[model samples]
Target chain A: MAEMYSTPHEILYYEADVTGKLSLPMIFNLVVLSSTKQSVDLGVGPKFTHENGVGWIILQEDMKINRRPVDGEQVILQTMAKEFNPFFAKRLYRILDQAGNVLVDVDAFYTMVDMEKRKVARIPQAMVDAYQADQVKRIPRLAEPTKFEEGMEADQVQEYAVRFSDIDSNQHVNNSKYPDWMQDVLGADFITSHEPTAVNIKYEQEVRLGEYVRSEVKIVGNTTLHQIWANGTLSAEAEITWTEL
Target chain B: MAEMYSTPHEILYYEADVTGKLSLPMIFNLVVLSSTKQSVDLGVGPKFTHENGVGWIILQEDMKINRRPVDGEQVILQTMAKEFNPFFAKRLYRILDQAGNVLVDVDAFYTMVDMEKRKVARIPQAMVDAYQADQVKRIPRLAEPTKFEEGMEADQVQEYAVRFSDIDSNQHVNNSKYPDWMQDVLGADFITSHEPTAVNIKYEQEVRLGEYVRSEVKIVGNTTLHQIWANGTLSAEAEITWTEL
Candidate 1:
């Protein structure tokens, strides 16, 4: 079993929506940040990776939410390096309440990229040794997010100019922001009236700096499928399952 | 001296910009949040204010930055209720490193708003007593941010759509976002090339939910003045003095 690392977090007010629960994007960010914390603990964090001319990039994630934490709530994020292949790695993250009640569960996949060439690089042996990542011949694949239903029209489309704040230290749009761009098309009323139960997001291409992205959502009943288009290219796609609040 | 409250915070990656320093808006948010923590410690947090039919709204702030904290750094937010008159209260905030070196200092002014009436209200006695605020006869006025020079045109204008996530619990755009709209006009290169040494910002009106905002900026030498207009009404104004990186 891989060793686990845990970090304490407080849900800041700005992270919560009108429903008082952590916004979807913030939820994603917290989980991803937990993994980063784990990487830091393993001595394979951004500094180490960047020094070696490579950096980790998240390509996909699937998350299940038991309940969303509200504003000013204290939560524990637990993460571990699960397994990896020659080309990819898989990590697990769990957000728990003070009493150890699970609030969210996620399985995230990552790959290392060469900073200079912007190409996927082989998983470094030093990282594997540091994380004790189980060396598997092939990493298992997560289920693809479901596509839009037949004849489904775009329920709503929202345009956003990627602000400088949207960029992260990785010089790319952070993974958490994709959900905001996607779900924001649902509007304020819908956001307040429903809670997300499950979310699956896949990144096809990186959204660069200062690029305007159009987020389109097609709602078929309680499940909304979202696509973020940047200049006619699909940047990211997501599917969210929601239940009435 | 007013009662002081101190809280510890870790700088998250998202809060850091390309320059590896905390974003200007985030610095403002942190200091303001420090005051909120003080309020909570005094048992007059959002819950208490909401139940009492009143809320604290920041009207203006002036900040001086010795240095901006970098990501992954642990810092302490120190705040205290300073002085107040019948309608306005002035507070002081400091962000310090682990070694007790000050990174940023701010003076913030606030007023109570009657949520039901959507109007400024008298400062409640209970809060004043709880915080042990000195009842001063008047709050000293802050220096106004300088207006544009003669015949100066807007250096750049950027339009933004108010997203669902932009609205805070107060049902209006959060104060932190105003600096973002103001400074993003400087573009990514300028942001990375310079650091803000001083900032003075004031609010004239609130930007309601879903309202489009136009941010205009005029740069004179190293100082940039900004105005945020929502449908031809000035919502906020600011001036930032920048130093070369």
Candidate 2:
């Protein structure tokens, strides 16, 4: 069994939307931060990657929100490694209120990549051991994100020039920014009337600074499919389901 | 003397730049959050404004960074109301490391506004009393931001559509996003080699959702001047001085 790590966070005003509940992007940010903190403590984080010239890149992620924490609410963010192989790893995350009620659950898949070669690489044994990733656990699989068909026309399309603020320490667009771009495509009216219940995303390419990316969204019923294209290349895709608030 | 509030923050990986040091926009976010927290505790926050139909709006702000905290560092964010008049209020903010070393200092000026009228309003006596603003105290003044000439051409200009993610509970673009937009105009090379030492900015108009704003930058030695225009109307202006790191 892998060790679980937990961190406490108070939802700041900036983290909430007009509805006074935590925004989807801010929720994703909290989960990512918590996971990074745990990885750093477990000795499989940036330090290890820098020394080995290999790094972990997230392949897919999906999250379900049971209840959203509001401004000034303190919640515990917890994460644990569920499974790992030479090529891929799976992790689990949960956010809980003080009363122990679960607020959100997330499942994420990651793979090792050679920084210099720009290709998938085998995970080093030491890295796997550090995270106790050999343990097998029964983790429920999240819904798979839909891939938009090539040449499919989108109902809404918006272009964004990747700004410096979007880039993180890795010199690439942070994964959390992808969800923000997708949510923006929904516009203010749709977002205000509905709240996200589930989100699934898959990363295909890296978005770099000073580059322009086009976001396309196709809505059908309660689910929305999104695709992000940098230049002419598909960078990422996602599926989100919303429920009326 | 008004009470000072302090909150501890662990610098998240997403808040830092490629150098692993805190980014300018993140630093501003921390200060703003701290100030908001303090105001809420003092009974002059959003809740109070909602009840009174009057709210505070930032007029100008300036920050000086002495050191930048890196990822995994735990720092203390502190703020206090320094001075207040019938028409304006001044607040002070400081960021200190665990060892009590000051990392950043900021001064911000704000004025009350009528939410319904969309115009500046007098600070109500009851609201001022709630914050204990009668006590006069001397506070250092920050450098005033320079205003650009109407006919001056910008060296570089970029347009950005205000996305839903950029809007706050007030249904307008958050003030912090303005600095992010201005910083993006500097490009990667300049940002990589230089660190911001001082920043001064003035807000003139509110930017609403679905609007397009143009960011313009002018460089002179170590200082850069910035202006944001919404449909040919000046919305905000700023000046930032950078030191080679």
Candidate 3:
């Protein structure tokens, strides 16, 4: 079995943000893309795409950031399976700096879906075999959700529209982008102190081309919960927490 | 005259970077898009796009960042004609925070090209007339080409392929991405400290879809000068100076 699956990524200019720091949303994006590449290398290649008309639907994700990284830092993104079931697969990610410092840790849960039907499908057998063969070390799932209640007041709302650029390879709003929606309502000040420690989302609907969604947030105790509604329907609900760095 | 064309842009999730801060590339992108929108607002509206059968080509850019803004900060992007010649047009931009703080100041030069002839074309009279009528606080051309020195030592050459994602609506590497390539050879550390005080680049070639361009860079004194070459021909070149913040 392979010991670990790792990919080296060069921080592109588009990726380096104005603060000269890598933005969190872009970090999540790179992680998702690198993870997809890892899956392909494991021989579960885009088998579902252009052939079986299948793709992975992100049910939820919880990520924690230790520190912000700067632009042009060559980063090594390492991802591995934490656990798998008939319907859901959980994966964990570690982002390492050049000197092997862990910059961020991410845990996400995804379910396979039939694109044509847009419904959750059983995990393909080939994928299960590939995960078993993947050499990456299996890590434990994150213990709990992120916290955002200390300074953030509850019952705030922010609205966003899906643009042409938001669609990814599968033509749906990329899963990594949802975290951005969460950050939008929280404002920049909140993002400064708290990084996403855990993100748990339930995807009940899909957002397509030219649609708009409203993020309604409520901070309950230590938990900052969000509900994303599209055209008055609950598309997804998320509960996240932020930790002081 | 349409009082100093100001464009309202909705921040997209894809544009949120790793730091959860908006990326420089995306800001640069919005500048270009807003500039064009200003032209469309003035009724110039890309007639040259159909006439010359070639679109605008960014020859050089100089962007100064005073502060970095984060996601969901709705700001106004104001653009105006600073100067133009028969061969090229220069534009200036101001990115304001919601509270009216100047986040960034940018100046750029672009030339129309005749695609079939593969050469720069004369600026259309209609385009020039439209922009000249709507000038706002026109500052003297921000670029001082005389400050740029040529013929320096060379050290390393790095190459990058233009991916599908790299292309913008204009169908070239989004003009903003060129700065990333410029920074790639400079190393992330040097680039972060050395805010671009001034820049001068000349685009001589177009990087087609899926073409790889090699970047050759040399650091001399306080300036790092670099060039992008494609198929053994020079595509663009820039000279940047480190500024004290």
Candidate 4:
């Protein structure tokens, strides 16, 4: 069996939204935490990468929610290094209720970049052996972000000046903030009245310090196509499916 | 001894700022999580209060950091209901390093409000007993938020439209976001180079939905005073002391 890690997590109220459900940003944080812990256990943690003059980066992620965990609810978070290529790797994560019913499923793609050259680095064989995950020669396909229709105009546009605190350990805007910047533009009326059912994100560029990004959203029914633009470039694109509360 | 609760928290990458230390907001979140767990263990969690038609609120908080915990560091979070009056209570929390040295100390003031009447409610004696904490006849005095020097005009101001997810379970802006909105206006240069040594905050008014708030900051040497204004009223005020990194 491939190596796996799991932990019990209690959804703190501070992590919940006005609807008393786990917010999308926090859901992303918690699932990432699970994978991080797994890496640490496998002995290829951040420190390990830093010592090797490399850094981890996320390229894309897809999330499907059967049900968002609620405040004060205890759930089990599980993650494993599922598949890998010489250039990229995929991690599979799931949140399970007490009854073992999966509440959320996520597939995240990651690659290591050399700190000095800033180029994608080959996956180390020893690191893959630590996790007991399969090494594949082919790159795994990630779900494409929701596509925008021709001549479709954004229903709403909001801009956010990046916060100093927005810079995470990566020394750049954290991946979790992307979803917050994307969906929050939907306005309070739609946000508080709807729940996200699924989300797909593709990270194209990193947000720089002191840069203000504009978030534009096109809504049609329950599916919303979103984009985050920084420095006049499309930094990220996403699609989210929601259900009315 | 009062009924004390403690938990181990590993500072994750998402929780750290660019400085590699725990961000002010995440520190607040972790300490609050410890206290929340204590309340749940005492059988008086959010559910109990909701069923009793009441809600918990923070009036003020003061935090002093002897040293900030770094990324990937494991620290012990301890909290206990220290003192209480008929209407207010004080919870003392400490974050300790593995060597048992205190890294941060915080004292938070809290009171419950009647959900329907929307007024401060008297503390129930039975509830106090559960914590095995002291009850005082007089309201406990708290450290006032740092007083501003007269004629001090804010050097910088940033406006933020309240996000839909910024509202927590209370249906109001989360107290943690107040610090983020405040310090982020210091810009990337100050935030990446200076580390906060202490923070004092007083929450006066709650922010409303769809309202754009302005964050104002005045810096004099190592101290910065901050304010959050919504609807042309001071919603929150804070003072932070920093040390050059």
Q: Any residue pairs clashing in model 1, and if so which?
A: none
Q: Rank the candidates by lDDT, best first.
A: 1, 4, 2, 3
- lDDT by residue for model 3 (B106-196), tens: 7787777886777878767677787773433333454543322335556656666554334444445666556656665554346445555
i-RMSD of model 4 (Å, 1 decimal): 1.5
For all candidates in order, the CA lDDT equals 0.87, 0.85, 0.64, 0.86
Sort by TM-score, top down from the best: 1, 2, 4, 3
Candidate 4 C-alpha lDDT tens digits along A40-82? 8778987788888888789888999999989888999999888
Q: Write the per-residue lDDT of candidate 2 for residues A1-245, one digit (tens) a residue.
A: 77888988898887887788998888888987787788788787889888898888988888899999999999999998889876788998899999999999999988888998989998888876877765444434556787667777798888998888888877799888898899898888888998899999988899999899999999888889999999899999999989986
Q: For model 3, how does the per-residue alpha-carbon lDDT over A1-245 read when each residue is reduced to its tens digit?
A: 33456887655434533344566567777777666677767767555443767788776666666765764468888888767766677777878888999887877877788888878777777777777733233424434433333345557777765533445556666665566676667654565566555556566577764577887788765567877778877777678767754
TM-score of each: 0.97, 0.95, 0.49, 0.94
- When 3 and 4 are scored with TM-score, the better candidate is 4
Candidate 3 DockQ category? incorrect
C-alpha displacement of A169 in model 2, angstroms? 1.0
**Residue A219 lDDT in candidate 3:** 71
Runs with alpha carbons beyond 4 Å of true place in candidate 3? A16-18, A133-154, A192-202, A220-223, A243-245, B1-245
Q: Say which prediction, candidate 2 or candidate 3, comes out ahead on lDDT.
A: 2
List candidate 2 segments past 4 Å from native.
A135-143, B134-142
Count of clashing pairs, candidate 2 = 0
| Candidate 1 ranges with C-alpha deviation above 4 Å | A149-152, B149-152
**The candidate that achieves the highest TM-score relative to the unseen native structure:** 1
